[model samples]
Structure formats: structure tokens, C-alpha cells
Target: MDKKFAGKKLLVLGSNVGATDIVQYARDNGAYTIVADYYPADRSPAKRIADEQLLVSTADKDALEAFIRERHIDGILAGISEFNLLIAEELSARIGLPFYFTRKQWDMIEKKSDFRALCEKHGVPCPKTYVTGKEIPEDVMQQIRYPVMIKPVDASSSKGVFKCENEDDLRRYYPESLKESECGEIIVEQFVTGDEFTAHYTIANGKVTLASVDNRYPIAMQEGDPTTIPIARIYPCIYLDAYIEQVDAQMRALCAGIGLQNAILFVQGLYDEKTNTFNVFEAGLRSAGEAPYRFIKRVNGINAMHVLVDHALLGKTDFDSDKEDPYMKGKCCGIVSFVTKGGVVGSIEGLEEATAALPDVIEYECRYPVGSETPCGRTLRQLMIRFVMICDNREKMAEDIAYLNSHITILNDRGEDMVFKMKPERIWGIQ
Candidate 1:
């Protein structure tokens, strides 16, 4: 409508919740948006916002490239999902679109073991990692100390990730990790017991800049079939002032060492209390999974989505025009997503009242309609609803969260209320 990208056609690879926002951004910014994914049009929220939807598999590189050429598309973008990165790389090469990563760089970051090795090669602090093939060797097995994390080398959102306390646990979970990866590879990393955090970085002209950091809250079900899943992200993190300098230094080294100096990177690491250092566990050359674009903008008054679109579309390197600081100064914000044990929802209650009563609540999003069946899983896909809250201080943030827990209720088909709790101690990384 504005003609910012009036004649431009932007192709997005996926049509999930995150991609929906990307599609809308393009449309709102005056670009003709096209979304390509195998998901049926009716089920794709992004397809509703896009000008066109190509019901082709994003993995079908040849077909997608042909579509791009035939349609005269101008640029390409993909969100947090890793599976679509290869497709983006392929289409970018075939059509000369602006992709943030080269295939080599993409491979290095997408494969967990490769990134760990890169960390070691560059002297970046990282958890001790051991790569395993189809069979775990006795020698390698002998070296693994207790309490290691077993996960796929090429998966996202902690899918197929397990914390093994002993050799027996490793043997039982190794195959499960392998199944989650397209590549038959898995890694056993010595678990660093500490607070977990994720830092966002932007690279331009070979210089790395820190965007923001958030305290990641990972939730786990301890009673039945224990499993860990990330549930919330709190911003204006408590450790920002204490650790920003060192974390920035380490990220600069990582970006320079990996030869990645023209895109955004989401770095996940742990603040190891034992070593008193931050050790990276994973890095991705893309956005993080938890709708960070919205969070960053809300808390810091910076539009990450605009910067990303401009960077990917026009290759514009300067992003400081909209930067603001002191960023999130004297403020606190949190994103809390809801989930169920997996069942057909009979009814939902208190959403409207709770949201209206909380003055600090800024945004509310629900993924499911009433009566829809919700899946039972530990992945982000199971997230049913999300609430964005902000306050003058952390005390108020905690108070708002507690109110929601006691007020909001989700009843399954059997009319049983699903218990929702936000235990601070269970939060993955909060030192």
C-alpha cells in the first residue's frame, strides 16, 4: 500500500506462527508477499496474510527455484526453523537473492557437533561435546562422565534432547536423538549446571554487535515421563550489566572465527557457576524460536523485523538508525506461552478477564480455537497461547505471572482443569 516494496516480491519459506508475522511485515511495508510450504492453505496462518501461497514443499529446491524464476521474485527469507535454511540457500544461489548465510556457514551452525568444534577451534568457551555415530564406541563411552545432554546434531527447539545421568540412560536415549536428525548423528555434551541465557547478535561489515539478551525459562514435567520444554523468556535480564562485556567479546570472536559477518545469530549458552564463565551450547544464524522479534521491539523500542527485512531484501548494512539505548533501561518484560497435556479442549476461561485486569499486559495471542484438539508434546508446536507482559520492575512481572496462573484455566474434553504453574526454581537459566 505504501510502495516501499511496491514492485518487489518477497518469498517466505514457511507459513507457521513466526512466518505469519514476517509475511505481514512484507505486506505492511509494501512488498507483494508469497509463502511456500507443504502445509494446506487453510491451516497456514501465514498464507492468509500472503498475496499468494505456493503449495509446494519448501524442500523441493528445483520446483521452488523454478517458481521463483517464473514469478520474478526479488528476495527470500526464512524464520527460526532450521529445515528451511537449506532451501533458502538453494533458492538464493539459483536466483541471486539476498540470503544471510552461505551453505558452508549454514552447515556449520546447523550441525551441533560442527559448531562445538568451531568453538573449540576458536577458544570460545563451550560445553565438552562428544559426537556419536550409529553405534556408541566403548572407548568413547568410557570417557563420558555422568550427566550429559544427548541431542540431535541437526534439530531445533530441544527436540530429541535428553539429559542422561548414566551410561544406561545414554544407551537408551542415543537412538532417540538419532531419530530426530536428518543426519544420523548425535552429541553427548557434559551438562553445565547453571542459569541458561540466549543472546541475540547482529553482524555487519565484519563487525559484531550485541542486540539483546533474555533469561530463558525452560519448563519440565517431572511427574509423568519427565521432559523439558522452553515455556517463557524474560527480558532486561538480571545479568545483562554483569555479563554483557564478556559475552560480547566472545560473540565477536565467534563471528570472526566462523567467517559469519553479514547476518543475525541467536546464541544460547549457560552461565556456569562452577567455572564463573559463559559457555555456549548452541548457535543459529537465524532468529530464535520464541517470537523474539516482537519481544525485542516491545522492550527496547527497536524494530528487528524491519532491520531484517531491509537487510535481506536490499542488503542494506547500516541498522543503527532505529537503535535505542539505554535499551530496556529500568524495565522488565516477559513472554509466557501456555500448553496442555494433549486433548480436545472443551472450554477455556479467564483469558479476557485476566488480560483486561492486568495493566501491564501488552499483547495476547491464542493459537487454538475453542473445541480444537491440542497436541501433547514438549516442542514449541504444542504452545497453545501466549501472553506478553511488561512492568516497571521484576517484582510486578512476577506478580502478574502469578495472577495469571491462578486465574486462567483450560479444561480438556473431560472437563478436567489443566494445572498451570510457573515455578521460578524450575526456570532453566537464572543465576
Candidate 2:
């Protein structure tokens, strides 16, 4: 058999869930893969799957360079996290490897303020936003409308984002919110009320070759939580055709304006039915979290994990253009995140039985161990478990989810138990 990437060695940074998938995909494509992570061998799942594991902090330049030198790595891939992204760019530059984004481009995308400014310069339809500090600037404050959204400029996953209704709310939350962020700068923007959605695409040689869009339904969230975890995502979004076209145009323009060349692009936006407009929110130069992976695979019959690896190694994708998955046509796939209220998981019922019954159920992952305490949102240990499922029939999808919800149980510290439930607003709409 002729190997597509026989001689290439791919070094994947971060051993989180996303990284492990990427590593496995690369290995399946005949590439020698090395998983480098800061955690110990036992804690790293990618380490178990890769050809070799290297215990090195990608944040440390010297340590990262030494590992690259010792291993003779030819390419690099980064997971969805921000820290891993910065390190990936640095290593790519230092080792002369094929990287998706340049150091400057990565920095621009990482910082919320920089990304907003780039969007403005390029005429992308982003929310009207302003930066704030000790005393809010008169002009900047005046520009923002009531019910504004305030967040840290450099935070990811929706950390420190709050909807401030007036000056009092802003004054009350401003100080602590700024202090809590890694970067002290904060962004205040006009909060648009509309249906939220996300777009995912892959750029190669500065052009978008593949793309998909999904409707976002936020599930669990508290005061300090980054954006609410998504409960379900419906693909081929139920939007006017013109609105989808507008979104696609905005994404293409933003990528071209920022000089974004290669890698996956995850863009979030809101669709205002009243005005028939799509407002651009945030764009990350990485794959959507594992939530959407199953949906994309089901709809397109393409493994995005393999696509990312192939692009990293050969600068081209191996998508079978003629082949398509009929299950996705005019059908919706939903992913429900099984969130425990608090504390360690005592027992999870019906997971194996559910999977056995519903083969379309892609994966059910327990992020924490049986006895480990699951941390609340805002901490690094937010995710407890995720139950991902898919089906061609929307009614059957709802039935499976309802059945799963009734079966799974999570107990807290006081012996009180709670089952995962989807907020009604998340399923239908806030209105």
C-alpha cells in the first residue's frame, strides 16, 4: 500500500480530548505521530494513542525547541485551546514546519480586541464594540447601547462575558471582571438579540475549501461560566437562504482581510430575523470543539479529524467529492451534553445500553473519574461528561435524549442526586 504521509512526522500539542482525536487521525493516515503535553503519561490519553509521548511544556520555548530537535518533527497541529495555539505557532516558526497560522495571525485571533479591530477595518458585520478601563471612555461608552455585553479581551470559551443592562450593572461588574481575566483589558459591545449560529470551515493556501453551519442552543451556564455549554446543534440551519449567503460572504471577507491562510475556522454569529441580518461574533482558527465533529461526519461522510491531519501533512484534503451521506439530507443531528449538577459521579446508568440500542450515538465521554469532584464552570475542570448522539429523524432524536435524561443520575456531595435536563429556552427559544 502506498502511504500518503509515510515519511512525515506530525507533532500534536495538548493531549486534551481534541488533541487525542487529531493524533489518532494522523496515525490512521500513516503519519508518525508524537503527542506532547504538560501532563504526566497516565493523565494523557493522546500519549497512549500516539507512536510516542513527550513530556514537554509547549509554553516553554527552550523545552519545546529541544523536543522538536530531538524528534525531527515535520509538522504541527494545535487543539482548540488558546495556550496550545500560541505554542503551536512558536514551534512551527522555530522548527520551520508547516503551520496553519503565523505567529502574528495567531496573536490577532487570540486577542478579542485585535480580532474586533481587524473585522472593523475589513468591513465585516461585527457587533458595535468598545474597550473599557478604570473610567469608561465617554465616546466608547456612549457608542454602546443598553443591554451591552462585557467580556475580557483575551479570554476564550466565553469567560467573563456578561450582559450588562445599564451603567449600574456595568459599574458593579467591571472591576472584578477585569481582575479575574488573564488579560486585564475588557470589551463592551452592543448585545444583539437574535438566534445564534456557528460556521466551520477549513482554509488551504488562503482559500476556503470546505464549510458547514449549525444552529447553537446554549444549555448550562452560571454567572462566571464561559459561554453556556451547547446542548444540541442542528445542521443545515433553518434560516433564509439569503442570510446563509451573507454569513458565508462575511466569513470569506474576514479571512481574506486578516490574511488567514490555512487551518480550520470556527465563526459564531447571530441572526436577527427582524432586520434579516447576521452579526459576526467570534472567529477561532481551529476546529469546533468535539461536539460538532459527529454531526459533520454524519452529514458529509468526511472525518474532519482526518481532514485536519491530511492538511497539516500534505497541504491538501482527501474529501471524496462524489460521495455524500444521505442520512444528512434534510435531517438534523443533535448533541446533548450530560452535565451533572455537582460533585463526583457515583453512577451513570443506561450509557452502554443506550449506545447498543442507538448505534448513531457517536460517543459518551465521562470527563471526570467516579470519585473525582467535578468543578463548577469558570474553573479549568468545568466539563463533567458529554453524551453525543445523532439520528436522521428529529423525533427519534428527542425520544432518545428524553430516555437518556431519565436514566442517567448524578449525585452531589450531600447525597442529593440530580439528572441532566435541557433548559426549555435552549431547545426552543428565549422568546
Report the number of clashing residue pairs per model: 2, 1
Best by lDDT: 1
Q: State in Å the error of residue 297, model 2.
A: 2.8
User: Which ranges of candidate 2 are over 4 A from the true structure?
Assistant: 121-123, 130-135, 139-144, 157-159, 171-173, 180-184, 220-228, 240-242, 316-327, 376-383, 411-415, 423-431
Cα displacement (angstroms), candidate 1, residue 233, comes to 1.6
The window of 10 residues in a row where model 2 has the poorest summed lDDT is 422-431
Candidate 2 residue-wise lDDT, 1-431, digit = tens: 96788888998888765787787777776889888877887888888888988877777778878877887877888667767877777777877776667867766776777888877776667898766443478676666668888887777755567889888898787875686567578888888877777777656556654356667666545655545655556555667374546656665777777776556677778888789887877777777674466566666766555656766788766655343332356665665666655666666566667667777677777776667777655332454666676666666666776776666566664666633465433444422
Compared with the true structure, model 2 gives a TM-score of 0.85
Residue pairs with colliding backbones in model 2 are 158-226
Q: How far is candidate 2 from the true structure (C-alpha RMSD, Å)?
A: 3.6
All models, RMSD in angstroms = 3.4, 3.6
